[model samples]
Target chain A: MITVSIEKKLRTYGGGQALKLAAEFLTGSVTKIYGPSGAGKTTLLKMLAGLVRPEKGKIVFNGETWLDTERNIDMPPQKRKIGFVFQDYALFPNMTVREHLQYATHDDAWIQRLLAVSNMTTFTSHKPAYLSGGQQQRLAILRALATKPQLMLMDEPFSALDTQIKIVLISELQHIFNELATTVLIVSHNLSELESFDGNVLYVGNQ
Target chain B: MDLSPIWLTLKLAAITTLLLLAIGLPLAWWLSRGRSGIKLVTEALITMPLVLPPSVLGFYLLLAFSPQNGLGKWLLHTFDVQLVFSFPGLVLASIVYSLPFMIGPVKSALQQLPVSLAQASYTLGKTEWQTFTCVLLPNIKPSLLTAIVLTFAHTLGEFGVVLMIGGSIPGVTRVASIAVYDAVEQMDYSSANNYSLLLFAITFFMVMAVFIFNKYHAKSPLE
Candidate 1:
């Protein structure tokens, strides 16, 4: 289980607002986070992944104190063992599809399996620029999974995919998430898109 | 006309470019990644050569390299090395003169990269060194190419700094630029014109090579 209580400063057009979040995620469960624009959904994910620092917070992951303001204990992102899919995909332009996975791990079997799951085996030698938008998005997902991280944070993971690809990929992802028993926190604006995942919904912002 | 000066100039530019890569890479990396008061001060100092008069820089360097001074004394005592009016001195002066040309491009390249790439590498359990070498370096090839070519070209064109510190010593301190000045002083217009044209052609070739390589690299499938 993972527990978090934090407050971060966010600057919007109107003024600055405090994004105070408190939540607990059960082990091996997928949690969908939805919010309006500029509601700090991505910030919440970053904070959880130890990429963003919160003004005040205590985050405990499986009894490990990742962050405790009162105790002055803060774990760096490198030690967190979390996978994050950036909104822009963040694919290394120079690295090919296979090279991205090779960068994360040396396990050949695992890499082949990931490539198969992402359906990008044929495009292994293709760089990000040569890949289609959906292919690039899938490669991003595959790269995040390359490390087999325990916790995955995805920001609009399917924003670039077509509806058909999104549906099929999410179905495959559901099985993989279950098999890996990884806790996932995905942020998306559209709720209906996540209907197939069957995860608990956490809405942010003033609706 | 002796072509030794031409070879000497190429050697100096080559050596200076290599040294700048060694020194400037780390400095540029630090300037781009570090956020501290020291970074600001160090950045200003590094950039001083860009704006300062070459003669002024050379004057200070010459003083520092003289055997009577503290730095020169320490160097001579420790290593029995002399710098002023020597080939080593010219190389040192060239490095100082061309530092910004190398560092500016590298720092800008590093700064332009998205923070997420580094973050992604970190989350993959890779160390900072691994991320820099594997992730960051591959993405900044163009910047490295630009830095190398610019530093080499800039070093080739250095005259005032070379003149003030190194003087004209054939096959030693007398680089192509200095040699051209000597030719003009000796009323050898034909030799001066030859030397000038050679330097111009080299600089032009280097710049053109950079443009062609960049265009070809951009068009390649890996891009």
Candidate 2:
């Protein structure tokens, strides 16, 4: 289980907005965080992943202290072992689709399996620029899963896909998440899109 | 025709380019990561060479290393080394003279890349240096090429700095540019033309190669 109580300041157009929240996520549970624009949903994901720092917080994952501002114990992102799917996809233009997976892990069998699950086996040699938006998005998800990370944080991960692809991809990924028993937190503006996943909903608001 | 000047110029340009790459890459990486008053001031100093006259730098180098100034005198006494009117002095001048060419494009290219690229690498458990070399630097290949070409060419074409710091000493201090001037002063039009044509041709090919390569491999929009 991962427990977090954190506060961060957001630089909004209006003024400085404070984001404070406390929650506990059970191991192997999938949760969706929905909020309006500028609601700091992404910031929360970043803080959890150790990409962003919380001004005041204590985050404990499976009894490991990832962050404790009062104790001055903050784990870096490299040590967090969280798989992140960025909002922009953030694919490396220089690397082929297969290389992205190869960079994450050396298990060729797992890499081949991931490519097959994403239906990207035929396009493994292609760079991100050559892939379509949906293809790029799928590649991003597969790359994140390459490590088989125990915790996954995704920010609007499927905004580019059509309904059919989204439905199929999520279904495929759910099986893998269950197999790995990964705890997943996904942020999205539209919660209905994730209805098929049937995960618990967490609503975030800016203050 | 004596070709030592041509060889010496090539040697200088090659050494300077290598040395600058070693120093400039890390410096540019550091400077691109953030903004601070000190960083801005350092960037301005690096960029000053682009606008300031080369002779200004040449004059300062000459004064500081003339064996009369304290630093020069100390070096001369302690290390028995002389910088004034020497090939080493010419090298010092070229590095300062060509610094901006090596730093500008690299810093700008690094800054232009999406910040998410590095963050993504970090989440993948990659180290900061690995992210830079494996992810960031490869995306900025064209910029690195441009920086290297411009620095080499600019160093090859240096005149005022070489002349001010290193007087025309054959085979040691006299480079092709100074050779051309020396040839012209003696009304040796043929030798001057030879040096000028060779320097022009070398620079032309280096620059042309960069342009052609960049056209085919321009920095991608995604980068």
Candidate 3:
């Protein structure tokens, strides 16, 4: 199980406010962070991924205290074993599809499995720039899964794709997650887009 | 054809380019990724050489390398190394002279990289060094190439620093630019013309190649 409890202040433009929340979940369960822009949805995800520090709180994942600001314990992102797929699909431009998979996982068997699951077996030699938007999204998901993390954090993963492509890719992703039993936390403003995924929704807003 | 000076100038340029790359890459990387205050200070220092007149830089270098100075005295006493009137001394001067040429392009390229890439790499269990080498460096290859080429060509055309510190020692520190001046002083106009022409031709071709490659590969940076 993963547990996150954090309190942080958001400062932008000309104002600031504090955010406080506590959440917990079991393995293989998908959790959707539903909120409009500027509601601290991404901030909460970043804190859980160990990319951002909370002013006062604790984050415990799988029995490990990843962050305890009061106790002065803070684990970096790499040690947290949490995969984050960025909104922009931060694939290394210099790396090919096979190399991107290899960067996170050295095992050929896992890479081959990911390629088959993501339908990227045919374009193993192509670079990120050459891939279409939906193709890149699929590759991004496979890249995150290659690390075999206990939890995956996706920030607007399918927002860039067209409606038809988005539906196809989401269905494929749902199948893969079910097969692997990987827990996922997705952040998005679109409620309809996320409704199909079997997950509990966390409605975040100004507090 | 006075090939000796030409040969010495090429050697100096090549060595200075290699040394500048060694020193400038890490310095630029640090400056680009460091805090704003540190970045400001390092940027000011790196550009100081560019702003100062080359002769003034050479004067300070000459003083610093004199046998009486601390660093110079230690080097001479320990290893019999002479900075004034030596090939190595000219190389040191050229490195300072052409530092900005190497640093500017590299720092800009590094700054242009999305912060998310590094953050993503870190989250993927790669250390800072691994991310720098495996991810960042490969992406900034074009900028690194630009830095090396510009520094090398600039060093090839340097004159004032070599004149003050090098003393135009034949078969040792007499680089092409100094040789041109010496040839003109001795009234050997034809030889000076030959050396100047060859230098101009080589530098021209290199700059043109860089421009042409940039034109064709402009879209490559978006990736």
TM-score of each: 0.95, 0.96, 0.94
What is the per-residue lDDT of model 3 for residues B1-223, given as tens digits with 9 covering 90 to 100? 7699989999999999999988998898898885798689878988988889889999999999889998788889999998999998999999988999999999999899988888788778888888988898889877887888899899999998889999888889888898899899999999999999999998999888888777766567743
Off by over 4 Å in 2: B70-79
> Top TM-score: which candidate number?
2
Rank the models by TM-score, top first.
2, 1, 3
Range of the 10 consecutive residues with the lowest summed lDDT in candidate 3 chain B: B214-223
- Estimate candidate 2's alpha-carbon lDDT, on a 0 to 1 scale: 0.92
Candidate 2 chain B: 10-residue stretch with minimal lDDT:
B214-223
Highest DockQ against the true fold, candidate: 2
Scored by lDDT, the top model is 2
For candidate 1, what is the lDDT?
0.89
Q: Which candidate order results from sorting by DockQ in descending order?
A: 2, 3, 1
Q: Supply DockQ values for each candidate.
A: 0.66, 0.80, 0.72
Per-residue CA lDDT of candidate 3, range A1-207, in tens? 888788988774125766788888777899988865777887887888888888999988778899999899999888888788888888899899999989988989989988876678999999998899888887887888788877789988878778776776678778777777778999988878887888898887764
